[model samples]
Target: MTSISASEGCEKGLAPGHFAPETAYLDTASAGLPPAEAVTAITSALTAASRGTATVGGYFEAAADARARFARLVGVAPGRVAISASAAVHTGLIAQSLPAGSEVLVADGDFASLVNPFHVRPDLRVRTVPLERLADGVRPGTALVAVSAVQSADGRLADLDRIAAAARAHGARTLVDASQSAGWLPLDAGAYDFTLVVGYKWLLAPKGTSFLVVPEDLGGLTPVFAGWVAGEDPWGSCYGQVTRLADCARRFDETPAFFSYVGARHSLALVEELGVERIGRHDVALADRFRAGLADLGRTPVPAPGSAIVAVPGLGTAAGRLAAAGVRVSSRAGGLRAAFHLYNTAADVDRLLEVIAGT
Candidate 1:
């Protein structure tokens, strides 16, 4: 069980003045609220792009700088990270690059983005289990062990360190979907072999944006669908000539939705300014608050920590009644799930607990 320390709520992040949007948003695990500074940065970038600043001067170059900024926020070298239109784009490319006749291990709780690619590939073999059991499922021939760093529905945090240790013992690589844990997970990028994360969830970036980090020593891994954008010298040909595929992170692609990049870059900057550790603590604390309040109502709640996600056993009751009463939550595994983000406060949890009791 993850325990959150309540005494650490200090005002040390992007500055409260920069955190606009007075509305209380409790669904950050789904989509985070962007900070005001990041919004301004994105808006300025978009405005300049519309005026042909990007196309006339240097297309994607500015975006590249933004990707570098994002890499810094996530604790990965800029060269090892690929900026993309969405998290799935990076994962799909990796999935397509799997070796012939390779079997992959996945946790049953993976996000749809990670599972769908395997479904489309008939040649690939996939095995799903509870996340705790995923590392044990890895075998000598297993090409990859993919699972979310944090469970999406219930905020059940995963032990990636243990999973990583298990994969290496079996000669398998690991791909972590940090979409649920990126902005909040306690570990640095160096801790995982490969990680895919999106700006929409934890970073509070706009939709249609994210990044992927592939280690410098990819161990012969190559993206089968590598495009011109992924090149190290995308335009080294000097005139309409192609450059070699980038040895670093750019290998993911060259051209992406620049507007989305701008949005994500802005969001990431806010996360960095706030300090990843601080932001993580804020959400973890809120989750603890929610669980405490819910427990007071005699509700069964999962207390595990790592991410802001928390779960309440449905207790064989319909979850709709609670949702209908101004409570924002989801029903999964015959239970109710509540996620916390910067926008959520202890009051939100208290209100949710009150509603659950009346239901």
Candidate 2:
């Protein structure tokens, strides 16, 4: 991994007046703290909307800009991206797009949204494999593979390049859930037939801001529920004109939360300005520091493939203890999950270790 300069790392820390003086937020895997600029953008948009100063054209202009930025970040064409409400919604769409009776393989440690879509369909088959044994589970008969870029439970990184190659050899499509890795890790959406991204986690945006990437090679995806925004001539079809739907992924767009898109636009800009590679290095280094600190407390971290998240036993107890001391963390996957993001620092890790050691 490349090293981030100390000055750059410090610049990535929490913005001024963003958090309480004594608080250390370490649960970024669940929901990121929005940047101050994003908050301001959201409030400004909401104010305009309530005052009837926001126009439909202006709302969609911002949405289009957001989609373009997301496309640039993921290395895909803007037309291949569709603004979505959440990951669960896109998971179901991809599951339904596949032929009936297709085999969908998912890792046991993946988020529930990856598996539940296929589970509810009687015509489709869903199977679970251990996170460590995911590649071995793919076979010729498999029709689709769904997994997270970073396992939500333990922060184990998935080898998407390897998995995509294996799936392609077996004539299967791959749908990657990038919710856990998007803003910090490099992602090439063009490599997969489908990719789901949610903004609240690493993107440092609020809920209601998410998107799906669907390449043309995957074929037309039937909208599970076509709203007024589903066709090429969206406004024209409002009066029952019976227009054709779009050939691109935009056909699947839902009526988005305009204010959320405004905030997401600014958040994406921040990540772009910082450069995802630099943020990745900063986050991994902090995670390493946190793991080393836990080791000093005589606690061993659960082994994971990457440095995005560090899990150790007694997570529930540790979370309570840390909370009592005004430090925030999450208990997940049978351990204390301390997810590191760009906002984290060595000082935060030191504080967590001090609490854990009862010092």
Candidate 3:
């Protein structure tokens, strides 16, 4: 609606100088491009490690910093956050901790990271429900409800508030996979018993870094299988000495990749500086324009209100054409899944539109 276009938003955040000019990558749902600051921090940490300048104390400090930043990003105390290698690991841990014969409700077609964990748990009964009916599906038998904050394939934003409220009323714990939404939208960890995030997707961090939020009261659901690092004193616990593990969420944090934490810390800090609200605005603006352009081409995109991912029909062919033209995109839900992020611009949207129109 405004004459002032898209690329202008990039100026207020990190400049897009880090990305190659020839390509317009719109697949943040798969992985995010780390900011220059994050890359620099990772490089420095690697150099220090190679030179034998990195100390155990430094590693702990960086990990703590990343934990605190991720906690802030999700509106939780640092003690409530646990670092993990991937969302799937934390998902499996939570799924395994549920009592035997517990009933779990999950939305059908959610990314495998959210549902696969429950599948392997023969003791738990997993029900696949419609995404829109998740709230209505909460029944007396449902012990847990797992959902993605935003559907990765079609960008359908889940009504997490309604689902969480319903789960609470039904005495069910709520777990939300925020892999595609955490860094792009506002999230309240207090709203759910557990929140899983993958750093490589929307957090602009390396693949090895991920976060899981477990409120203090939920600490009773301890890790089903813990590594030596999960104890308070890794060395002492390993040497046949019984020791207390951390009372907080750190009990689930095994030996983490410290270098990935360094990069994630820097990236999270940059996101905080830029402001998540502003980033959401920038992303939605570009996505809205892209959707509008699709409409102009007689193509109706899948509805994803207030979401950054836009989907349109013939996605596979369109993605192929776009990639051949040096414009990167993804195909999902029988449509082209173009995800706009802090790094994208109006020019990128225009290029995608042009390619689609030409095809």
Q: Count the clashes in each prediction.
A: 8, 1, 1
Give each model a TM-score: 0.86, 0.93, 0.93
Q: In model 3, where is the ten-residue run with the lowest total lDDT? A: 1-10
| Per-residue lDDT value at 294 in model 3 | 84
lDDT of 1 by residue, 166-263 (tens): 88888788888888887766547776778888878887877777778888876355656566665566555334434576777776663666666656
Evaluation by lDDT, superior candidate among 1 and 3: 3
Error of 3 at 259 (Å): 1.8
What lDDT score goes with residue 244 in model 3? 80
Please write out the lDDT profile of model 3 over residues 218-291, one tens digit for every residue: 54575755677677776667665336876778888867888888788888887777667777878888889898
TM-score of 2: 0.93
Q: Candidate 2, residues 1-359: lDDT per residue as tens digits?
A: 44467345643363344433347888889998888788898888889889989888777777888899999999999889988878888888887877888899999868987789889999998889886677778998999889999877778888888889889999888899999999888898999989989999898878888889997753457787566677787777676643687667888888788888888888888877777778787788788777777777788887774557888866666788788898888998668888878777778878888888883
Name the TM-score of candidate 3. 0.93
> What do the candidate models score in CA lDDT, each in turn?
0.70, 0.81, 0.84
List runs of model 3 lying over 4 Å from the truth.
Answer: 1-14, 17-22, 234-238
Considering only N, C-alpha and C atoms within 3 Å, which residue pairs clash in candidate 1?
Answer: 79-249, 155-309, 229-253, 229-254, 230-253, 231-246, 232-245, 232-246
User: Candidate 3 overall Cα lDDT vs. reference?
Assistant: 0.84
TM-score of 1: 0.86
